[model samples]
Target: MRTARRWRHYLKPLVFALCLAPALWLAAGVRWPAWVDLGANPVEKIQHTLGLWALRLLLATLAITPLRQLTGQVEWLAYRRMLGLFAFFHVAAHLLFYVVVDQQFAWPILLEDVAERPFITVGFAAFLLLLPLAATSTAAAQRRLGRRWLALHRLIYPAALLGCVHFWWQVKADIREPAAYAAVAAILLGWRLYRRRPRPAVTGAAPTPARGSSRD
Candidate 1:
């Protein structure tokens, strides 16, 4: 277990860097657009990339519990909170980029988009769901909230679902990518439901048939 603990220490930082890599790459592309081709439409590319990473990381965060259960390794949980927070970070960045750059801080236009666009509506709702999860992610908040924390965190299910819908609805065509993400989200959620299903009680081997007293 010394080895396990040591690996945990090293793994967190490595995973943190890996989580940050996409954002860093996007930042570099923004900084040096001439060197890095963000396609003809850099802003759109960056926005899509950020939103994509947000969904990916959110799914990854949800996978932690199932992964731990399947593998029986508690270590997989070590990164769950970090992964969740990064998911929120990317999502928040995605929204901010849209509001600041894409929409130029135009609240009227932003509200119009959210009001008129189904994709934007769902994406904004997903962001709102994630907001509280990110806010109360700390150990202190977890302890203070107790069971309510678990209940509140359950919002992630809908958030992830909404995010997938947002992606699918936004896509003009070629829905393969969004479909893949939706499939993964569905599997993860299905596994959670399967795991949580009530099991049949053993009843101590049927009480040895009670010496054949009227019933088998």
Candidate 2:
């Protein structure tokens, strides 16, 4: 029973890895007709697909705290780092696909894309914001940076917001999906604010009588 109970701890990561298996296979040159199109590059589709997963994983990682609090499953905290690293993996893959396959090693084109495309700009900003969080994720960095590290990691909120905007801006129509993500992000952020709000102090203690003994 103990082992079975602990098995639940592995369930999320297992499911995530299983979901990503297809992407990994595709990345390894396993082509699928469902993903191929004569008008669109398969590589770009792969990159976009991976990028979407990255964004979802990032959101999931951010949701851990709220979900744990709501559910009272403190064990959930153990999975957050793994989910975050998986998010970074997918994001890195997306960036590499664009740089290597789409742009053909053209720095000029890459720079132009960042300058002209708002979606790209926001996505880039999100990636940049995640860098410090990822960097200080290690125990050594946490020890070295102390409280400053936590303050820097708080940038995840804005980073997530930028990621949502980047996704929403890229869609030309049928924005419901993006809007859903944005709503979720908003709720998560709102939860934090609500949780942090100061409450009125209770005044239950009876006022102490003035110090005047029977000397009266």
Candidate 3:
């Protein structure tokens, strides 16, 4: 445990860099279009990439628990918060890019998209749900919220489901990618439900009366 704890000090930085790399790469593509091609439709490419990473990281965050249980390495939990926050980070960037770049901050059109477009509606809902989770992810917040914290965090399950639906709806066809994500999410969430299922109470049988003893 000591070694794992010590190694985490180094590992966290590496993990953080890995999580940030996609965003950096996207930024570099924008900065050096000559070197890094963002395809013919750069705006769409960037937005999709950011949203993809959000979904990937969200699923990864959910995987940590099953991974820990399967591998018996409790240390896997150390990275959950980081991964979840990065998921929120990417999703927020995804929304910002769509609003600022795609819509040019046109409130009427953006609101219309949210209201009329099913994919956008779910995606926006997912982001709204994630907002509180990210805001309350701090240790201090967890301490302050106590048991309520766990209940609040449960929102991730629905957020993830909505994210998957958003992705599936956004894609014109070829749902294999979103299907895979949904499958993994199902397994992870199903495992959690299985674990939390109420077990039959272990009732002890009443002791037999002493042989030949009085009924008093």
Off by over 4 Å in 3: 201-216
Please give the distance, in angstroms, between residue 1's alpha carbon in candidate 1 and its true position after superposition. 5.5
Q: Flag regions of model 1 displaced more than 4 Å.
A: 203-216
Model 3 lDDT on a 0 to 1 scale: 0.88
Candidate 2 — which residues are off by over 4 angstroms?
1-5, 12-16, 28-40, 203-216
Clashes of 3: 0
For each of the candidates, give the backbone clash count: 0, 0, 0
Per-residue CA lDDT of model 1 for 50-167, tens digit only, reads 9999999999999988876776556677788999999999999999999999999999999999999999999999999999999998888887887788889899999999999999
**Predicted model with the maximum TM-score:** 1
Task: Please give the distance, in angstroms, between residue 52's alpha carbon in candidate 3 and its true position after superposition.
Answer: 0.3
Q: List the residue pairs that clash in candidate 1.
A: none
Could you tell me the lDDT of residue 105 within candidate 3? 95
lDDT of 2 by residue, 8-49 (tens): 668766957865775676655535555634235677677778
Per-residue C-alpha lDDT of model 3 across residues 71-172, encoded as one tens digit per residue: 666777889999999999999999999999999999999999999999999999999999999999888888888778878988999999999999999888
- The residue pairs in collision within model 2 are none
Backbone clash total, candidate 1: 0
How well does model 2 score by local distance difference test? 0.75
